[model samples]
Target: MRKAGWNPIWKWLAIIAMIFLLAPLAIALLNGPGGSSGLYPSPNAYETISNASRSITRLPFDYDTSDDVEMLKEYVESNREALSEIDKALTQQSRVPLDYTVPLDELLNASGTVRLPMRLLIVQARVAELEENPGAAADVYAKMSVLSPKLATGGLLVHVMIASAYETMALEKLIELTPRLSAVEKKRVLSVLTTNARKPIDFDLVRERESDYCKHEHGTVRGSILLWSGSALVDQQVDRAIETDDELLRLRDEAIDLLGS
Candidate 1:
C-alpha cells in the first residue's frame, strides 16, 4: 500500500514549498538592480552549467553509463573560463544571512532568473572528483549548501531539481565524503546542513492552494542512503534526518533493498 502522506494535495504542495526561499531575492531583482546581482548567481553562470549539462547525450538523471562520465569530464574541461567567471562572482558576494519577505505571487512572476551558486559548484565538485581530489570536491559541495541555505537533503526530483541535477549530485557527494572529512571540514558540512534544513510541510498552506511545496520525503531517505551507502558518518546523519518523517520509515527497507544495501 502507498504511504498515507503520499496523497495528491501534499504532493502538490511539495513542488512549490521549496521555492519560498528564493522569493525575496527574486523580488529584489524585479524591483531594482542594486545589490540583487550579488545576492544571486549570474544568469551567465547558470547558462554555462546548463549548456555544459546539455552537452552530454543523456539526461541529468542518467548515471549508469561510462560514456556519461566521460562526457561530463569533457564538458567541465572545456568550460574553465566560464567556471572562472563563476568563481569571481562568488568571491564578490557577502555570505551574510539575508532577510526579506514578499507575497508568494510577487516572486512567482519576478523578472529574469538568478540561479543559486549551487548549480555551478556542483559541476566544479564533479570535476574535482574526476581529478581524484576528494578534499576539493567536498569543499565545493560545502559551498553549495552555504549559497542556498533553504535547500535540504530531501526529495529526489523535487528538492534535487530545485536548481538542477547538479544540486542533488552535490548533496550526494557531500554525504559520501563525510566519513573521510576532517574535524573542521565535518563541522562546516554539519553547520551548513543544520542551518538550511527545510521546515515541515504545513497542511494549511496546502489547503490554501495559493502556494505550493513538494513532499517526497521517502525519496529523500532512499536517495540519500543510496548515495551514502559506504559512509558511517553520513548514515547516522541520514538516519536522524529521516526519523522525523514517519512515512520514510515505512519505505526504508524497500529503499535499502532497491539500492542493494
Candidate 2:
C-alpha cells in the first residue's frame, strides 16, 4: 500500500479540518506548514535553482515553431505525474511499487536512425530540469541500476551534460564525494546540493548508498569510483555528444553556464 503521508494533500486536509475543528488552528495553518517548523527548504533556493534551469534553456537562435515543441510539451507534461511522485518520494517517501514497464535509462537512450532535431530540443529540457531539480534527479538516480565509466570516451559535451546534472546535489554530499570525479564535477554536485544541506540530511539514506558513490569520499577514492563506474554511461554520452557536432556543443555549454549562474 502507498504510505499514508505520501499524499501531500493529507497535510492540506489536516489544515482544512482545523478550520472547522478549531478556528484558531486554521489561522496557524495559514502561517504555512513549515514556516515556523523550519522543515521546508527555502522557497528562494527553489526559485534560484529553477532560474538556473531556465537560463540554461534560453537560446540565442529562435526555437523552431514546429511539431517538436508539441511533442516535448507532451513528454515533460507526461512526467508531471512522475514529478509529483518525486516530491513525495524525496520528502515523505513511500513503499508502494510503481508499475513501470520500461526503464528510464532505456528511455534516455531511446533513439532511432531518424531522430528529429526537435527531439534534441526535447531532451535538453528534460535533461536540464532533471539536472537542476535534485528531487527529480533523485527519481532518475534511483532508477539508474548500475554505473560504468567516464574518461573512456574523448567527447567533452557528454562530460558537461553529466556534469550539469551532478551540480544540483546539496553541499555536504558534494564535500563527502570521492576523488575520481574531476574538480569540475565535485563543484557542480556541491553547488546543486549545498544549499539543501544547511539544516540536515537523512544520514540513513546516505549510509545506504554505496560508499564508492562520488558523494561518499574526499579525493582519490571518489575519483577512482567515478572514473570506473561511469565508463559505460560516459562512453554512451560522449559518443552521442560527438555526433551532434560543434553547434550542439555550444548550446550545451551555454546551458551549463546558465545552470551554474
Candidate 3:
C-alpha cells in the first residue's frame, strides 16, 4: 500500500536507482568471466562492471592498505573501456522499468544478495564525505535514494543511508550552515527524513521466514544496519542539534510527529 504523500514520479526514480545499484551485481553474479549460459545478456560487460564496482565499493574501507588500493587501481585501469560501456548500458537500462517479479523462491534468495551493493554504496558515500568531497558524496547518496524511492519506508538500507547521511552531512556542515539558510531550505533538509522516521516498510514476510536468507547471520544485516544507523543519527544529530536551536527543534519534532499521525 502506498503512503499518503507517496509521489508516483518517485516510483520511476526508484526503478532507475535500483538499476544503478543492482545491474552490475546482477551481471557479475549471473555471468562472471567464466560464467556459462545465464539468464541475462551481455555477460562479459556485466562481469567487468561487477568487478569494478566491487573494487570501488571496497576501496573506501581498505584505503589504509597499500596492496588493496593497488589492486583496485589496477582493476580500474584495466577495465576503463568495459566500465564506460557498462555505464552507458546502465543509463539506458534506467530508462526502462525494472521487472522485479521472479519465481518466489528466487526472489527470496536474491533479496539478501541484492542489498549488498547498496550497503557498499552507502559506505562509499560516507567515506567520500570523510574525504571532504561532499559533492561527490552527495552524488553517491542521491543515486542511493533514487534507487530506493520508498527508502523512507521500504526497508533497513534506506534508513541507515538516511541516518548516516544526516549525521555525516547534517551534523558536520549542514547544521552549521542551517543558521545561514532560509527557513524553506532548512525545512526541506529536515523533511527528507520524515518518511523513514514513520511508515516502516513491509518486506512481504521476508523478515519472518525461517530460511537461511531470513537469518541474521545471512539476511538481516541490511535491516539491522538501518535500524542502528537511523536511531543513532536521530539521537546524536537531530536530538542534539535541537537542544541549541529552539526553532529547529520544533521543526524536526513536527516533521517526525506528522509522519506518525
Which candidate should be chosen as best, given lDDT against the real structure? 1
Residue 245, model 1: lDDT of 35
Best-to-worst order by lDDT is 1, 3, 2
TM-score of each: 0.35, 0.21, 0.29
Poorest 10 consecutive residues by lDDT, candidate 3 = 90-99
Residues 15-64, candidate 3: write the lDDT tens digits.
Answer: 99998899666644543322111144333322333344444433344532
RMSD of each: 18.8, 23.0, 20.8
Greater-lDDT candidate between 2 and 3: 3
Top-TM-score structure, candidate number:
1
State the displacement of the C-alpha of residue 75, model 1, in Å, after optimal TM-score superposition.
Answer: 3.5
lDDT values of the candidates? 0.42, 0.32, 0.39
User: Rank by TM-score, descending?
Assistant: 1, 3, 2
